[model samples]
Target: MIKYFVMGLRGFFLLAAKIWSFVCYCFKRQARTVIQHQTVRYEVIQLSPLSKHRLSMLKRKTLVLDLDETLIHSHHDGVLKPTVKPGTPPDFVLKVNIDRHPVRFFVHKRPHVDYFLEIVSQWYDLVVFTASMEIYGAAVADKLDNNKGILRRRYYRQHCHLAEGSYTKDLCDICSDLSSIFILDNSPVAYRNYQDNAIPIRSWFSDPTDTALLCLLPMLDALRFCNDVRSVLSRNLHLHRT
Candidate 1:
């Protein structure tokens, strides 16, 4: 009889322990769910839009582009020669001078750049900013102008102070309104200074075969619709703010 009583006591203790463990597990799961819900609610509240007009204006105007690797390909082999096709006029050569040395000018338009620029020019004022020398930069700018009519203003190497590197940020000083400015460059270093005013894009080398330019159209469209930086931030504040 004593042996049977001891066995019963052992079974009752095991059952009580199991019930206590289950209660603790339920409380932990509920706490995790509450934390997850709070995080989602905070994210939703941060991204709300500021205004319709600012959004519309940002969608309409201004694109500042980096010139060298972004627009033209600089080859390590040698300066590129302009290609002319059969049945063309013998004198139909593209002439461009860089640092007083006459270099052949070639139009290596990216696969959708012509079409993308045509659509964007209808809305945004386009500018070119490059660390390249004035002569070479102008040559590329001229080509863009002749082909797409999109290069309205150009900032060459001379416009920037090389020693400080931070001078690149000075581009913002020229803008009357920070909301209207946008920059696209391959250098993360340069874009870091203008994170508030610029959008960094990967360099598109000048191979007629490459097709990355098409991906930029939607980004341009987004900028065209963005009127104020505040609106973009308001919608993405959780992601953008430090």
Candidate 2:
């Protein structure tokens, strides 16, 4: 009995060490990213009105975004609704007919997504590509865009390539110019074929404090000026570098 107990204790300590190491790594990485974002804040503030116009006039690159967990979380009766402890709340609720049944969905927007969109739209021509079916994805996009025209065009599930039970997005469908286009997605498999042009973000679900979108502004702002987005994205030193 004592031998078994000692063995179990050793295993427990090993597991605890692994967990602690992972936590420390995540904390340190976040600290570094926060410092970088602070530096970018000053640079963003210094830009003049004229500078913005000039930047907008430059050859705008295409920024393809993902929906669902990337920008918003959709919760239906069957889906998991966030406990919604403090600040986060569903932006809107929608009733849609899916396969002859009307379903109500509660959508919670990722924090800072609005400001992030406003800033990135000026720099890059925005496009939304989602793995979800058109019936649902199109409605969500419309609700999020609110007819602002910031989100230029959208591609739905029909456009995705189904491979081995996973839906993979084809970036070429959105833009022929590989150098000028890149995709912002939370799922690695979506961009598995085009890894070089992919910027991975953490999948968000009801976290009111989530700042993945805000933290991305600096790098995205700088990307517009680069000749080829792949050249910069290949470095892959991002907050959620997949």
Candidate 3:
């Protein structure tokens, strides 16, 4: 009887420890998120009043999207899956020339990615901004595009600004009009300087049930009609902090 009681006591302590550990982990995550939020300066650009003619003539809004974790996840070293689907092989087998040696990379597209790009293209000028080598980024973009003609421009790692051990994407470098340009990326650091014009997304990996891309369609569609994209983004910026 005493041994059984002791075992129960031990089990309770083990469960308690686990619960405490989980709480600490959650607190740490929240703390990190808070820090990221505080880092954002919320510097909304003061735009010159647009003339009626210029507003009417403004083309489509510009959407700069990140690669890798945002649209797809890739690894240079991995056991090639027999097929992503029953009869389909991996999406694309790309060879990148690195240091005079060829390195192969396997890419997997995010769920609903094709539909996302197709629909978004109609509403915005799509640009791929990735902190990865051009060789790799171009191949992945090609595979995803497949002549669909959605992507208007591609910016690679060379275009990114490296600071404090992380790459920061400067929207100003791409275009001077902050009101019409926005970025979608998984990394908060990438858009730290442009928080007012950033839409932070969760990193996508191998989740077949992931609906992030599809879920964004409604919001993206609405943003296309906004006079200034940053005005719409700034209101929900808190929800995206790391």
Candidate 4:
């Protein structure tokens, strides 16, 4: 009788395990279908439009912007295209000492970056955080600044923590209030440790027609009024992909 009871209990457990696996498999299938549909149809879509009623002014939040791919893309050997206007600064070269050898890299600033920086500086503290080496990042930042003094701070690769062989930008290192701080990065991996506080952007390579920065103005404007940035970001963050 005891053996029969034990066998009955084992069968029940096996059935439960099978049921659980089937449920998980179905959920995964549905999630994949949803993600694939979003990728193709809504890749450049905007977040839910912010209501005018929610635009209550609050304490200024911290906006951390990534350098490479987010604001600019640089390469060691890419040829610089001729500037549309003679005085316009399209691309510049930075010489840095790496491994005791001087290396020169070409940097191309994203279109409308200057205007974006000027506008955002009024709403939040602007921080340029890059995974690139400080030697190169600082020079590029300096050129962008051009004594306008818009960028509030700068952080480099040494500031990032390595997690599972990928560089993660831990927001806790900089801000005590994670709710009020938001990071805009082109690489999702950089913000995997803090997805809710991140707004992943598409990586830019030298596309003259790119208008991503301009499109973000409305979202950024809405975010300035929120008491906690995560509340707004959580709704919008999932829409973007690296």
Give the whole-model CA lDDT for all candidates, comma-separated.
0.59, 0.82, 0.81, 0.78
Tens-place lDDT per residue, model 1, 1-242, is 99999999999999999999999999998886565334111111222265454554344456777765665554321444523332223211346565676665444444455555666676578888887777767776776677655786888777765545553534564466767776766665554555666655556553334545556565555555544753553343232232
Q: For residues 1-242, could you state the per-residue lDDT of candidate 2 as single tens digits?
A: 99999999999999999999999999998987676445223145657797777676667789999998899887785655454543445799888898999998888888777778777886778999999988888888888888899875999999999999999999888888888999999998889888789898989987656788888887887787677888988777453343
Better of 2 and 4 by lDDT: 2
Measured by lDDT, the strongest candidate is 2
Taking the tens digit of each residue's C-alpha lDDT, what string does model 4 give over 59-152? 5688999998889877763346632333444478788888898787767888778777877887788888888889888898898888988774
Report the lDDT tens digits of candidate 3 across residue range 1-242.
99999999999999999999999999998886566334222222343466434545765789999998899887674447623443434567788888898888877788678778877887688899999989889889888888987875899999999999998899998889999999999998999889899888999866666778877887886676678888889986776764
By lDDT, the candidates rank as 2, 3, 4, 1
Per-residue lDDT for 229 in model 2? 85
Candidate 1 runs further than 4 Å off: 1-60, 76-100, 105-107, 147-149, 164-169, 206-209, 230-242
Ranked by TM-score, top first:
2, 3, 4, 1
- Number of the top TM-score candidate: 2
Clashing pairs in 4: none
Q: What is the lDDT of residue 177 in candidate 3?
A: 94
Give the TM-score of each candidate.
0.58, 0.74, 0.72, 0.70
Candidate 4: Cα lDDT at 67? 90
Please list all clashing residue pairs in model 3, or write none if there are none: none
Off by over 4 Å in 4: 1-57, 78-90, 240-242
